[model samples]
Target: MQESTYNNMNAARSSKRWDNWEGHRNQINRILHERVLKSSSTDFCKAAIFGAGNCDDIDLNYWLNNVDELWLFDIDLESVQQGIERQNIDTKMIDKLKLFQIDVTGLDKISFFNDINQMLKDSTPIKKVVSYIRKIANNLEVIDDLINHYGSFSFVASSSIHTQLLYPHFNQMLSNTKDKETLMREADYLMSTLVKNYNQLLLNLVKENGTLFIWTDEFELSSDRGNLHLLPQFQREILNSNYTFLSKFIYNFGLKGAVECNKDLLSKFPNFADRLIDKTYDLIYWIWHYDLTKHYLIHCFIIRL
Candidate 1:
């Protein structure tokens, strides 16, 4: 199976040194333990994380030591290795970390990247492009090698990858194309389809009564825009009230994609919330201080399947 071109592009764009994101890593680890690991009675014998890019957002040592085996899945395997090396994890625990170079979207199986490139080269009409996207999304099938061999995992997580499932590739493909309005409409449909399927794949990989942790980078706030400085106050108010405040903030800042990015994951709640252990507080929100310049609005759900 060919890897999606966008995955490789994403790997290249990731920073080599993760020293700056220590706080974000710690925050992620703390939440996983509090919300998914310690609260549950399930034994996380074999755990897997999709989109384990560079493994920076997670606590490698804790997972390696706790789980009987830790499976890291990403389209780029090298990033996983570099992550381990960066952490200076003990070599003994390293054996527990299994790596799978796989695309969770299964786009490669249908030749999505190749097809898009060919379509662009041929100057395919917007109508045909929309049709192609719908066809591929409808026929999508995610192949899991781990299940047949190792069976379902005891614990599973998706590391803020839902928004990434389609947008980057779509943008890369339509960069030079016309008919923005039509393409955006089709992109929304394709993304909705992909998110549903991707969510199912995560659930399928979990054993009965196993815990699944999923999060997404819902929106971005940048210091460059001068509003990131307000996060300290805004976060408290936003959380104190409902998320309705978020829309106002977005409008004030003229930030694009926040609403759609948030809805991408939030909309799935009704379908999947039945299995959620603590619906009252199952969803957790935080700020991922990505760097000195940018922070991401992140929300996570802890589901028991």
Candidate 2:
């Protein structure tokens, strides 16, 4: 099939899978709380979740307990709306949370850069290529306003890592266009933007010696085997670049099949499942290997600023 056709098919499959995965809301929450959040600092007051899917999870509620202000952004409007309607996520809190519909993949547009430039002209020296940081900073302003209006928070959290695999898939799908090189350049641009944005955001939000925790799935590695390289590149950028390193905990054994039938599916099709699972496992392993094992896997970093 042509690349466009393949991408369309893959996009359809991805959408369907996310819809199905939404039902495992509680399990995802449990894992995040048990693994990622329990060890985080108890001094955060404002929190934000980029790529906040159907924000109906227990982990979020835990943050809401301590967080005076919350911000949630996602590319899917329907999912965000559904979260509001079904999850009873406090319209009051929702008002404070500042939900935004943004496609992180679309951060390459010049318009986005322009917006970033305008927003951050007053604060710091933003790199020319790192315009995407503006959106993060803009989002932070919302959180900052909340902090000013309400009070300080003791915790901040995001459940954005669940869709890490989509970055490469989207990049690959787009690369098949006639403008493959252009698409690749755009992917690089987007990654640069995110790294800058994340770095600045970390600098701004994390208190002096404050902690930040990121929760994400692992998706690529040499030993585990996978075809994609997008996330690996991004992960490398994070590690190689400037960021205080912390710790990486591999919940490999903890991630049993989220569903009871998943075991049956894995048992029946071990090879296929192994291929899929290995890609994710290796990605996680690589990040943890390079960062955690190297004593640099600290998703939870402390900033002196």
Please report the candidate that would top TM-score against the real structure: 1
lDDT of each: 0.70, 0.40
State residue 83's C-alpha deviation in candidate 1, in Å.
1.4
Give the top-scoring candidate (lDDT).
Answer: 1
Q: What TM value does model 1 have?
A: 0.82
Worst 10 residues of 2 by lDDT: 253-262
How would you encode candidate 1's per-residue C-alpha lDDT over 1-305 as one tens digit per residue? Answer: 23455447546644633666677777778876676676545464788899887777878987776677888888777767777787888788978888888777677766787787788788888689889888876777656644573336877888877766666766766676676668767777777667767777777787876777877776677867666777776688656855556545544542233344345445655564444344533666677777778888776667665
lDDT score at residue 266, model 1, on the 0-100 scale: 55
Q: Positional deviation of 226 in candidate 1, in angstroms? A: 5.9
